[model samples]
Target: MPAVKPDLETADAVAKPILIRAGVALIFGLTTVFVQEPSTLWMKVAFALYLVFSGSAMWEYLRREPVPVAMRSPLSMAAAAWMLGTIVLLFLSAPQAIGLTVAAALAVGGVAELVAWFGHRRAFLPARDQLITGLAGLGSGVALALGSHLNPHGQLGIVGGGAIIIGTLLAVSGVGMALDVRKARNLEADRAPGRVD
Candidate 1:
């Protein structure tokens, strides 16, 4: 073989998180698969695990994507500050923790945008990619968390587990750029080229 590029460390750094994302996805997928019977505490533990995964994935996606100069100019420090503040605030909110956590995520995403603008000179996305991904991830994850609606016996198997599947769907959506691209092309082919294709 030709000389190997010496980037094992860098490659590992990148692969580690993507692998973690896949693992989390698998956990969620499996949770969905076996929604028939699971312990109450296990269900809660699974959801908690999901929350951690979402936070990690969001953190990675933001830091990796190139900031449009304008967006970079705006979001850097703001996002960093909010990310720290909300992590603490959301955790302390107890029963309302899930909702608070989602709010914090939204704020974190917003801050990322601001950081992007400040660091660069423009907004990274016209559609605010970070916000959309974060919210969907947060919302679905929370929906799953809140699924445990006081069902002493049924919470885990029914509500909680179902929510896990839903949250997994959201997470996949966030990470599915290639899928989106394929969908876009398919839709565009159905339309004429210039007509918003």
Candidate 2:
């Protein structure tokens, strides 16, 4: 039987979304520093777009065959849906309501990652990475929630800070994951018969 050749196109498809998301996160993080008000229309729109991009990237990642089945738990699906829903609610609901919703979603996502970590700890790479990412989400979520309550003005401080943290985290993780995928693909190609580097 002929060996299945590694598909560069497939590899690119998997890596592209992650890189794009990382870029967006980095850009958003940098811009958030200058944003004085979190409730502004532009900020809301940007966040809405972020949700859309994040949900799309997750959907793509879940579609990849290399991802473990254990990682695609119901909780993960719910988190993706919540992100999408938050985009809609950002425009329709009050700022505080949306902020609360985001905080809750982040918390749930963090818990989901923690579960994934414990469930698949033997896998090492994914388990450890998920734990780190999960902790980032959990910490940021808690901070955002606290900021909402502590500031009588608004969640600008919390949101801005959270954006920077989340952005940096996502960007780093995204790049790392992309590089891993690329390396795996290259290794597979090298192993194929008649293939030259």
Candidate 3:
């Protein structure tokens, strides 16, 4: 039997959250790229903003949407990690803290996303996008951890670059999901009774 296409409602539910994530990531990435040679204070502020904003977005979505039971924990875990990282940054001002905090947040979020992808591997969610994003976050986190001795600039670059790459991937995934919804609607219309081919 052929695979069934997801209904518009189901696809939209999944796509909206992914698009929100993509927006947050792209904005953070752009900020890092434009801010040249950021001072320790600037990096601290930027990182804090990124974590809180991203976490808030996820938190709001979870409260508003009836996410599947299997997926809810991982998403909530990621949001919690971001919030925790923000709190940690508020107390630590050292340059090294930036790398450590960013690494921890990414690793936690990455693991959560990977878990969600594994659980939903056969479902309607965009598993491929989730897999790639998880990998990117995990890989970047590992790299930052290993480069703990590097200057703040080096640490910022690694995390910022990862954000840009993941943001781009999610942007593409979001657009693809939106297009799929439109195409599915068109196909349904064509197949309806009394409709012209």
Candidate 4:
């Protein structure tokens, strides 16, 4: 019997929309700053919109998740919860609060990761990878958020929040983008010169 090849087609298709929305959301964020409609209420609305967008992006990722049926939902929910929880804390409190929130989130994520890691030992991504990524993103994002809210005034808060949001968005995107490019390179390396996916 022949081994079934993994469907790289589906993977690429899934990634496209996910990356597109994320990129668009970043641009929209920047646009909001330019429009000068970034009122405090408007900022909260932006945060809510971003949350919805993140949830959608996550749904796309989960479609390709290597976890089992029983585990996938829990992990997805956990990921969403942690992401939103971190964002909420950032908007509502100080950056230092992120430290405590991250500590708590990682603790919960650690347990779930440990369980999933043992259960899904065959996957390309170990559970701990997700755990670490979640924690690091939450921390940096909160720091950026806190930096934005400093002594709200005309020039400082305006530029500050803009820089912080854009900076964190780029930072978060960097890791995923690098991985995507690396994966494509590896694919190219494994195939003939004229071959492409």
Please name the candidate that would achieve the greatest TM-score relative to the true structure.
3
- Candidate 3 residue pairs in clash (backbone atoms < 3 Å): none
lDDT of each: 0.43, 0.59, 0.78, 0.46
| lDDT score of residue 101 within candidate 4 | 47
Residue-level lDDT of model 3, residues 1-197, one tens digit each, is: 13444445655666676778778888888877787788888888878887787788777656544356778789789889989999999898888767788789988988987997888767735655668888888888889888766776777777778888888998888778788888887887988999864
Better of 1 and 4 by lDDT: 4
Most lDDT-accurate candidate: 3
Candidates ranked, most accurate by TM-score first = 3, 2, 4, 1
Per-residue CA lDDT of candidate 2, range 74-174, in tens?
33653575485565665554565555656666666667777877787675343454566567666756876766454312454554455565556656765
> Cα RMSD (Å) per model?
11.7, 5.0, 3.1, 8.2
* Tens digits of lDDT, candidate 1, 68-162: 33443344433453345444543442333433443444344445543443443332222233343334434543543465344323433332343
TM-score of 1: 0.40
Q: Could you tell me the lDDT of residue 131 within candidate 4?
A: 42
Looking at candidate 3, the ten consecutive residues that score lowest on lDDT are 1-10
The lowest-lDDT stretch of 10 consecutive residues in candidate 1 is 1-10
Model 3 misplaced regions, further than 4 Å: 1-5, 60-66, 183-197
Which is the winner by TM-score between candidate 3 and candidate 4?
3
